[model samples]
Target: MTEPQAYLNGAVIPFSEAKLAVTDLGIVYGAAVTEMVRTFAHRLFMLEEHLDRLFDALEYVCIEPPLAKSELKQICERLVEQNAALLPPEQDLGLTVFITAGHNLPYLGLSELETCRTPTVCVHTFPLAFELW
Candidate 1:
């Protein structure tokens, strides 16, 4: 079986390869916004509402996502479709979208002194695991 894929900063790669650097503000300072949407019958549920909430959170933190709302939605859908083959017939997926305040150059001592301008966007999905509930 093939491993599922994940979207990391505009590229889709194997889920295991999707990683974040230590200098990223999301990990260093917890400066990130996230949203989770569940699938019903292999279809996304309330995606727009979730996106709205995600955007609102981004606005609250002053972080700008690289993709606009429509683009992000399309990406999320594509990601879900890409990983659908790995899912079981009876199971649904939990899609997660997270945007971080990009890498903190100051943390790496680059001297550029920029903050939250280039956000890191990631979209990934996992089985719903209804048995665990």
Candidate 2:
């Protein structure tokens, strides 16, 4: 069976291949903002509202995401559509959206930092696992 999919930056690829740099500020200093939104009957729940909060947090932290809210929303929906087919009808998914504070400038040095101005954006999903509840 094919692995599920995830969104990293502007690409949608197999979830297993989605990776972040070791020097990412999120890993080094935990400089990231995240959001979790679950699905109901295979549809996103309160996606707009969730995006509002996500963007708000990003703004508060002064992290400018690479994509606008509309673009991000479309990506999330596409990811969900791609992944949902792998699950049973009764199963749902929990969507996770996160944006990190880009690279660790000091670690990467000034020249490399110039090319890494954009924050890292990712959206991935996992089965709801209601049986555990």
Candidate 3:
């Protein structure tokens, strides 16, 4: 079986490689927001509602995601399809869509605000442990 996949900053990559830099504001200042959705029979649950709340939080925080909600929905669906294949028919996945407050260049004493100001967007999935929940 192939490795599970994740969406990171507009790219689909191996889940293991989906990482954020240490200097990211999400890490440094805890400036990040996330929404979690689960699948049922490989179908997303209340996806539109989840996105609505997520976008609202992003707006309140003044962080503009790099992609539109439509595009992000596509990515989430694709990820669910790809990652869900790795699980047994009875198992489902929990998807996490998160956005960060870009990097903390001032802490690193870097002047490339243009490059560092782009928010980090990621969508990842994990098999749900129903027993634990």
Candidate 3, position 96, lDDT: 98
Candidate lDDT scores, in order, read 0.88, 0.91, 0.92
Name the best candidate (by lDDT). Answer: 3
Flag regions of model 2 displaced more than 4 Å: none
Q: What 10-residue stretch in candidate 3 is worst by lDDT? A: 107-116
Evaluate residue 19 in candidate 1 and report its C-alpha lDDT on the 0 to 100 scale: 97
User: lDDT tens digits, residues 1-133, model 1?
Assistant: 3998999988989999999988889999999999999998888999999999999999998887788999999988987887877877788999999999998877766564554357888999999988899
Error of 1 at 103 (Å): 1.1
Task: Return the clash pairs for model 3, or none.
Answer: none
* Model 3 Cα lDDT, one tens digit per residue, 1-133: 4999999987999999999999899999899989999999999999999999999999999998878999999999999999898888999999999999988988666677875779999999999999996
For residue 62, give model 3's deviation from the true position in Å. Answer: 0.9
TM-score of each: 0.92, 0.96, 0.95
Give the residue spans of candidate 1 off by over 4 A: 111-116
Tell me the lDDT of candidate 2. Answer: 0.91
- Please identify which of the two predictions, 2 or 3, would achieve the higher TM-score against the true structure: 2
Best candidate, TM-score? 2
- Model 3, global lDDT: 0.92
Worst 10 residues of 1 by lDDT: 108-117
Ranked by lDDT, top first: 3, 2, 1
